[model samples]
Target: MRSRLAARLAALGACLLLTASCTSVSGTGGRPRPTGPGSLWNPSAGQPSPSGANAPFDADAALRRIKRLGFTADDEPGVLRKLPGPLRAIHSHCTGSVDGHCVIVLFFHGNDYVGYDAHGTGNSSVVSQDGTTVTLSYPHFKPGDPMCCASGGTREYRARWTDGKVTFSPPLPGNPNYEEPSP
Candidate 1:
């Protein structure tokens, strides 16, 4: 009987150890499960943020700033009135590091903020961020290129975030297949 009871206790302790090892509690006191790259911990890996306290990228606010920088419909000949709509349609993707540094790309149809144009036509991607510097590589379509044809050339844009502001570097010459910098 003594040996049987010891064996049962040992089994129970082993089971408990296994269970504890298999699961961990996150800082929020929730069970820690494996989440993909773009999950809550990695906000920049998914869609752009609408607004948050000290969020790295706020799409609405960024659009407002871009407008203030004279990047408006008036700047483009073919662009009409700025369309009033959710900015998600224009947002391509966002990626970032754990330290509040992130990069977000907004693809403008026909290089215009007026409407939702098909991707890869005269589209231009604006990579913005509010974190550590990141570099992006995207195709630069030429004037009047067909939506299905290849890009005229490739361009690399770097954005550096510092002290609540981001500064974009001038376009750098690069190949179309250049790899993007990891956040």
Candidate 2:
């Protein structure tokens, strides 16, 4: 019985050690790793997190709120991707796109809809974020280039969230194919 008890204690100790090791984000000196984008703590985009922005995201609530925004009633709003940062952000894909691009990153503060990145041209679909800047990559078309294919190298634009809204660093790309969503 004593041997069995000793084995159980040893197993428990091993499990605890593994857990501690996994949870340790400190550096060699036991100081927490630098706090920044890649740090274990404060992984936000280096901006002061908005109020209640770190709260857990409630998908149902977000969906309900988004529906009221007059975006669409036919295309169901769905999460395309979730971004990492101090603020909870989701790249939502749904309908009601005027520029033919149906994806945009929606920002949320504690499941409450805040704002979203600017609409993308049909060519721009790749989105990424660094710090507080969101970048969108799209095919670049030189004069005379066909609409389907762009021979000019890809172009990228960045947008930043500030004062509770998204502002494009450069002006939004102009889409000749833009059309108003039919009522």
Give TM per candidate. Answer: 0.27, 0.44
Q: Give candidate 1's whole-model lDDT.
A: 0.35
Q: How far is candidate 1 from the true structure (C-alpha RMSD, Å)?
A: 18.3
What is the C-alpha local distance difference test score of each model? 0.35, 0.47
- Candidate 1: list runs displaced more than 4 Å: 1-131, 171-183
**Every candidate's CA RMSD:** 18.3, 18.4
User: What RMSD value applies to candidate 2?
Assistant: 18.4
Residue range 59-129, candidate 1, lDDT tens digits: 45445533332223212322212322222223331111232111123322212222211112223453432
Tell me model 2's lDDT, rounded to 2 decimals: 0.47
- Candidate 2, residues 1-183: lDDT per residue as tens digits? 999999999999998865453322344222111122332122242234244556544556656545443233222334422444434445444434454345444555444455544433344543666436667665666677776777766656666656655555565533312322122
Total backbone collisions for each predicted model: 1, 1
Error of 2 at 38 (Å): 37
